[model samples]
Target: MLHALAEQNTPEVRKQARRYAEQRIPLLRGACVPVSKQTPRDLVDDAITDIFLGDGDPWDPNQCDLLTHLRGAILKRTWLEIRHRKLVRYSPFDLAEGDVETVLARERPHASRGDISPIVFASMIELVATELRKIETRDGPAQVILECWQVGFVERREVMLLTGLDDETYKLARERILLRKKYLPPRLVAIVEDLLDRSA
Candidate 1:
């Protein structure tokens, strides 16, 4: 269906694209954190344009349906807009005590340079630490791993060595941590939503 639409520039294809964008606008808006000066309609239109023009990432029909592919593209565009806004709003004084490069080096030595603001990055780390601490309250191995991660020993081998966990145990602890994604606390969600709103 997507291929057929992309290959032609007929009035019917344009009408279909408009209808698809209209249908997806509300859903994409609700899912994405808001960006200043960019509306959900804008994102939807851009995604549709990219897909039809072959200017964005290549779409694979075998991998997913057209709707799913369109959603991914819109979300990707939203993320990029958010990052661009962050970069535009960033100031040296945002990290008055230290520089971005220094903080990035200390907190995440393995992470590559990206558009994420240092202040936002630190907030994300704190949020992760808060969730990890909740897990640690019930799981001993989680506590050990969390402690190791706090001190920047995040490599699997290093964490295992410091925590004295075998491969299976380490994997189990990691799995438990990953499972937290399905059950995020409401307070955390509210906090993140508020941050996004303010950022926008």
Candidate 2:
């Protein structure tokens, strides 16, 4: 099964594999202490051990590197009692003001001259803004966006769309996509629409 998954090249297959890995890899929370018979408890514990301790043979090497790392981390990570520090709270809108064009240009030099598509950069900005909004509303922490980026969507395009790109880009969207609005905060609009769409 691991070998098959490792060799999987299709988008559909890899997407399914990503989803399976995320759903299957969960922390062992509450355990049923088997008092009468240690068999069931032992079996469950060993399975957990196999997953956390052993080399990730069940994970696809190419597609499941993150999964493998997470598994190893669960077992091998040392407990740290470092003092917690407050997160840098800034104007959520400040992220939008940070020279997006210059930043994108600096980070992706190929993006200039329509080489990398301006729409794609816009989509990323919108996505980041969406996460910032979550922090503003107390709906969830800003960290959730990073977490979702890590484990939820398999494809980068899928993530952009999930963040309300709708089409390949906001400009491609039929109606006045809030994401494409010049004056309005694209990230905030995307966040509201994304939440509303989910509820609907």
Q: Which candidate has the top score in lDDT? A: 1
Lowest-scoring 10 consecutive residues by lDDT in candidate 1? Answer: 108-117
Whole-model lDDT values for every prediction: 0.57, 0.35
Worst 10 residues of 2 by lDDT: 78-87
Model 1 clashing residue pairs (backbone) = none
TM-score of 2: 0.21
Q: Write the per-residue lDDT of candidate 1 for residues 1-200, one digit (tens) a residue.
A: 45654555456544554455444332223333344334544655676677777889877666655555666676566555545755565456334466534454444433223223345455554655566677857688877887887776766777998879999999999888878765655543544454445445
lDDT of 2 by residue, 53-111 (tens): 45433443555543343333333321010111112211232233355544443444333
Candidate 2 residue pairs that clash: none
| TM-score for all models, in order of appearance | 0.40, 0.21
Q: Which portions of model 1 show Cα errors greater than 4 Å?
A: 1-38, 84-89, 92-125, 129-188, 191-200
